[model samples]
Target: MGESSWAIDLEKQITTAEVDEEEIKRWVIDLEKNMEEEEMKTSRSIFKVPTQTTLLHKNAYEPNIVSFGPYHYGKSHLQLMETHKKKAVDYFLKNYGKPLNNYVKALEEVDQELRDSYENLDDEWKHREKFLKLMMFDGCFMLKILYEYKETLAKPGSENHDHFNFDPQLCLYIRRDMLMIENQLPLLGLVTLAAVQTGKSTVLFVLSFCYFLKLESNSKNSPYSNYINSTVFAEHTGVLNLPILIMDEITEISFLNLMAFERKAKGMGSAVSSFLAFMGSLINSEEDARFLRSKGIIQSTLGNDKAIVDCIKLLGKDMYFNPHSEMCLTQYRLNQYYLNSIKSWNKRLRDWSSNFMQTYVKNPWTLISLMVAGFVLSLTVTQTYYSIHKPK
Candidate 1:
């Protein structure tokens, strides 16, 4: 058929075709219902890592030694920790002198909300008994681990203390696994278990051993920056200061998962994401990484400067930045400072003045020489003035 004729025929057929109104309406209704359900799922804090991000670095987001919540629960590798979890439960009950059933009942009361906190929970975990059991076991295990971690911190000499039969390597693996986004249980479950066991909140228990790297802030509470002049006064300095980042295997894994979680969860600002983006901007080469290390800004045990740069590049992959975020604003300010010629010149002048003062005036001998020269110059000028008036 000719191209014009074929197009006309197709248009005619589509226009003349009978439409099914009822079926169309049913399809529309179904779509709306499904969309509403998906919208409701946004409240869920736990989620499978997006495929695009996972493709970049899959292992960073997956649990290794253990799984905490429904996302990675019951996987073959993670199943090895089940026996340990049970042992933790035993230790928890004996240490607190509480019946196991009481803790189970406590989690049972909030089980529905707990289930809703996770996205796309499996049918096996949907069973009330199984879900409550998981919560009780995992919560107790986490509490026990926290107690041990706290003790380990309190007494550095007790590293050999075999708590829950966990060796140092196993404990390290557990820490990395727990930091994964998909491997997090709802704090509600842990808090409920704590209240039932200790008759109080779980703030101390839950927050134990959870440390945060403090980012230095600027005048507007944004990320801290450096200025042209290192010795500039605090009030006049335009510095964006960042926290000293210690990059190793565990730190890399933890930050990757944290950035993923911050991306998945709503209303949580992209602080980590922004920080990674800023770091990526700074460290594009081994030389850049080495310079940062020399300044004590980046302490990397990740082998070499090249490895640090590569690690940062990996972290920055598929990451998003919120332009309105404080870190982004800080970056914008830095770019402005770089691009503004007037500001650059002003900073150069300040730096030159400060350097001049430090080099020439601040030294006792140099200051004395300048003072003696000035005094001699003044005396010679006075003598010349008298000589000129006397001659006249």
Candidate 2:
């Protein structure tokens, strides 16, 4: 049993005291004591982020997740739309970006469908045309639109998604930090667009952000904030945590104002109201997540072993989480948020359906059809999530 009598063993038992995370500490403790004693060893601390994040020049140009609310203060919407446009513009101007393709055009071609399905119906079926050209469908006109708007909008062709679609799309995922910035946007102004249910957009946003993190972790630099920055993918988290805060004070302030003012406006649009409600979810999510994270006071792998999960869930929605050595920081927590958001969203969706059902209770079958569609959207989201996380 002497240390010298040991066979060729490169193992060290993982002591509960050495593991910084509460979850990991519990996990190790749950293992057979003998195996753990023989397997664990003194390990280096894996907390802290890098001093400077390496960023891809292209990523700095990548789309931004937005908290675009009502259209009047569309400075937010403009930014979001520009993000998509950046992709289109990149195809011709940037370097090696892709074309918008027919998917966008299909929407344009289905004018009647747009009229049939859209609440507002007619004014802007073609208004988005110029946007389509500069974003989705490239044409000779793109250069002209790019030319005229360059001086006014951000460096012209370099406009980001934030400038284009203040409203988040399935593709636009706002980070916690983006809305946290002072005067940029309020926490509530952000759309839980990345969530799966009520705000499936939130789920899409986070998934997309993760993809960016993965890509930026490549040999290139990534402009994404450190919390989820891919640039520091390797290298031990070091002193600099991989997370960065994303805050937009203006967005938040404007959103509060927009809600107060729009409610009394004479010609209020349902789209505008619906959009505001969506933006409000971000705040609700932060509140709820924070409450959940604080449930049992667990430690994290972040600096000084702080309660990072709690922070991001509540006030930290504006913050991105950094990485820890040999582990994925906040993955479980983030997934939990996604699941919770999805659950809430589904319930809200049902509420909306119930309202629609009452309107068509006379036919009964119409009520049945709407219910079917809601069911389908829900299933689509489930399938999407499973496919993304399937035993990889």
Candidate 3:
């Protein structure tokens, strides 16, 4: 009777173990299904700086003077810019003749989409009203900067009354900060504001903004100047007709963040990504930096040539790139240039033996003189050999 009772107890324990295993399997399956559903939804475009990039150059990724998005929004050092941003917003509304409420309402409508653009925003920023205000203020400020820049360009040397232009260095730093990867507002915000204010498209606004970033024509000092001069600008507009060839002065942080955002939001084949990869390929050394400088492809007030090279290297550190993406004809041309340079060097090496001889024997008189000298040396050597063996 004791043996029978023990067997029954063991069987009940085994049954419970089986039930637990089945429950665990069901839980795992549900977890995977939920993960798949989440992936199907749109992912965030703005990201915290990746560990690899940040570890190399933390200062490059951090905002120094002004912060644009929620990532660095409330920093004590950046608070000074808040007042300027508010003023810019006021100016934007006044110029567009739209009430602040209208802009706020527009932002509210796309609030969810805007939130989706940024990864891991703070809980306080999660509130709809707060998020809308953030977007309204930030977006308007960016639009205002672009507007003022356009005006300045349109009417140069005409009593620069813009507050940002009061101190050129401060303005430059702010512009640089705006380009930082962590210091970005959604392009959607800018687009919405532009559409509401003017009947123009986002492309025009982007082009104008980039222009304000000072992407001038390729300087004669740029290594790419010859290539640019040889080809028609209209033929190779890259992936989006962006003026990527003249990105010499853009800050490292700005370029990296822009490319990161483009990659996340627009996918792998954006013109911005392609241009970055192309620049990365070109900038491997100081010589490369010098070449770029010669072509006016790079212009920096960051001291010297080494600084520029270091900056480019840091910008490209651990960058995400797909080699097979569509970069228009730019990638193909760059590859061909690299291959041709190698082939040319090989040809020079192959002709090196002939070149050496030609160096000393270029003219007919020089060739005859060398031949005579060689014949005399050979005759003297033969005579010496005979003397040494003359039955000594």
Candidate 4:
């Protein structure tokens, strides 16, 4: 609802998804697997051939990504997770007042109230909370911000943050793709910190990719960011940076489209079809998916020619994708897909209607089971609601 105010003084925020217990168990098992594999840094396959140049050579000149957002907003949290703060001396000294070996001993001497906040946790989030509190002591965000703006952290006479001065020219690539390039830094990233709700959290999660890119691009000259570094000095940049922003919000989209598509059927179709068509093209034609697959363009995968054509078609026919040859295949594909949507999925298409997920979920057997569950839940909720609102 609101950003977490330090003034409120709480341990954990006490908010979580209401996913089923089975889901929680699955989530924990995944976490364990992730943790167990955290130390892994290399892999190889029999089919893999020796490269003339490592990825470092190819990505050296790639554009860097930047978050272009506000403060708190879990920027630091995301940075720490990606950077792995627990692996270094600077992080150790910065996080716990004493060095790693003696920090716990010092903690033992501290006040019990303070100890409770740090030691009372039984899970990873509690550890995160304890870490965040430690951040307050030496400028919680300075390390991360400086790390991203590593050019600042690398200036000849760089001292604590105040001495840090960012090199404007070092950003040779504007990264017009997904990285937020600006005349100045903006505050969208910080305001989004409180987005724990499904809708907001989902959007916030997408922005983390942007943040990750920014850190990658900016960490070129960071003294401490050398986990990926190869130079004695900040010699080369962007080797670790991925110059892409691909939002495949597949899970979120299914529900959103159902709402928009339903509204369009009720005579709102014209008003909403453009958006539907664009999204449909975006997914089906697969611009990001194809680009990602080019292997040469990004990571290896097969290209989605349909998505490429659909995206080009959206730019309109007059602006032919190849004006010299006057190619307009994309426009034709757009027309074809839209026509297909209408011909195949419309209410008049009985065959299509029969195959829809809604039809499957609403079948007689499913209807009967849903009705029984609904009746039971209705009684339970009604009894509780009635009791709560009664004469009192």
Candidate 5:
């Protein structure tokens, strides 16, 4: 009886070992499948702020007035915009003559691709149905804003037609909120929805968006307005050259988010990074801010040159920039420009000239003495010349 019991126990041990091996094999296969799926979705664009960057200025990455994407969708502070978003969506669909279901279906098609663009999405938001609804609302809200801005620009008095057109300051905040890194919907999503509504080419729609950015950056009376308007409307075939480096609370947030996106997307040589680097190089001091103001490069409503300088300096802190990127090249060019500036000259002749002016030309008493000495010397020279050659 004891021998029979030992054999049964030995057989049970072997069976358990075989079952463990089978479970291990199943786990490996599942892991490989998950990895393959991740690889297929690796081309992400939008991202959560890295902890390192967020620690520098958390508020800059957050939307103050409105939230567009799922990242900030459920915040208590941002919930007020939900009604506004619904109204905008309704307005957009009504104008486009499409039912809300049509837009919902359109977004559903690209739901997975849209999900892939954002990182660290919550488990609740990971549901396909919930994410699709988010894309429809947020995407349409953005398109509505852009479409309204375009209409307002094309027809000066058309802003009154929009229900959400508030005070200028509120509008300014909304504009700034839209550009916040975390507050963005995918450009492809916006373009796709716009195409569904307007039947306009993507290129033209993007250009119109660029035009809105330009107009937002510049004041109505800005001297550069004409040039910017012409460049955007002219026969240019490249990306629009929007001036995004202005030193202000809004622009600083906008650029920081854009720079963050460029960094995450591995677009190290992008125009956004280059512009930021260029602006950072140009704004190291109050004098630098003043110089940019004189050149019409800084169009900030924020008061005081020091404020602009400080804002720019703050924006550059904790930023990740590649040394060999286009932004670095822009920094190199700026350094070269500074080295060639007249203020940077320190040659012997320049030193002597500066010293001479400071000592003999700057003080009233020394200037008067120099003038007297010059007159006396001129008289002496005239007298000596007359004595030598006067009646010869």
Candidate 6:
């Protein structure tokens, strides 16, 4: 009877072990599948902004008036530009001086390359014909917009503005939308179209857009170094620099997209994040933004200084500061300089002088009174000294 009881317990333990082994196998299979999917997705460059980021500023990452890629292709609000896209196709064909089929063929050749550019392209765009159409239209429209932008830059106030029938405000919205991360069309598609159009290399055409945005590699020197002038940093003795930032309506969108790309793209450097974080440190309030604006360090086309402050704060939020980055190390150095300055007598004198001027000198009359009073005190001191030493 004891042997039979022991045999039953051993059978139960064997059954439990088999069940656990099966469960472990299932978990391993699921993890492998998930990892495979993630690995596939990771190769794409363009991506939807993370939900947490969009929740912070939904409009910053979304297209408003025009849709470019598959992400925002069919939104109702952006549908108004569909007709303009057709117009853009017409203009692009004419400007290319080629048959429509030539450009279409060019795009068809790179269809797979374009599809691979997007991380989460929808099934609706899976059909080769549909996807090719999207690439052609969006690419042509983007090319048209960029050409018009170049023309506008070359001839700033010439009444000849061809915006594919979009009014000025809508055109501005298109520009802003183009800077969004998810609203990006593949560069390969654009380059193909441009090459087909110009019958030449795409370098010059691509450089036009780069030049428009002034996208340049950052220097190792201080970002605040004012190559043009150091007048803004005149008050400071040791550090002779001030940041030169140009803030416009699209500045926020440009910065947010660039930072998002940096965050998403593996091996991509964090220059944008670093610069924005540094700016965020400098701009704690509207007053700081306004002071920079007044000193010409910040040139804002936005409505107010507060908008600039809010935008910088928004960009700088949720950023990871890489301690080894140039900007981060520079910030550390600046902080140390500030701390040392606080301990120095020269800084204290400057601070006192600034406080006295702000507190006591309300106007020219107050300054004049202080100067006269100082003169009187000096005269009395002189007289007292002479009186104390008379003929002795």
- Residue-by-residue lDDT tens digits, candidate 1, 1-392: 56798899999999999999999999999999999777767768777788888888878888889989777777898888899889988887888899988887788788778988887777788689888888888888887787776777788878654567777688778888887878888878888988988899868532442332222222323322331111121223666555567786687787788788887788877767776787788789999999888988777778899899878887777567778766676677777766675787999999999998998888989989988999999999999999889964
Clashes of each: 5, 79, 10, 13, 0, 0
TM-score pick, better of 2 and 3:
3
lDDT for predicted candidate 5 compared with the true structure: 0.70
Give one digit per residue, the lDDT tens place, for model 5 in 42-67.
66767788888888887878888888
Better candidate by lDDT, 3 or 4 = 3
How many backbone overlaps does candidate 5 show? 0
Better of 3 and 5 by lDDT: 5
Q: What TM-score would candidate 5 get against the native?
A: 0.68
The lDDT of each candidate is 0.76, 0.34, 0.69, 0.34, 0.70, 0.76
TM-score to native of every candidate shown:
0.71, 0.21, 0.64, 0.20, 0.68, 0.72
Query: lDDT score of model 1?
Result: 0.76
Between which residue pairs do clashes occur in model 6?
Answer: none
Q: lDDT, candidate 6, residue 94?
A: 72
lDDT of 2: 0.34
Q: Evaluate model 6: give its TM-score.
A: 0.72
| lDDT for residue 162 in candidate 4, whole number 0-100 | 36
lDDT of 3 by residue, 1-392 (tens): 36698888999898876557888999999999999657644656677866765676667778888888889988999888788889888777777787877777777787878887887778998788877888888887787777777777789976564755547688777788877768888888888887777756554444444454444443423332233223322323322122334434556655666665665554534445555666676688888878777765566677777887777676666455556544436557656666876998899987996886787667788888888999999999999999989974
Judge candidate 3 against the unseen true structure and give its global Cα lDDT, from 0 to 1: 0.69
**RMSD of model 1 against the true structure:** 11.3
Q: Where is the poorest 10-residue window by lDDT in model 3?
A: 233-242
Give the Å error, residue 327, model 2. Answer: 25
Give the per-residue lDDT of model 6 (tens digit) for 184-278: 88778888988888887575444444533433322324322222222233224555355466778788778788789888887777766776777
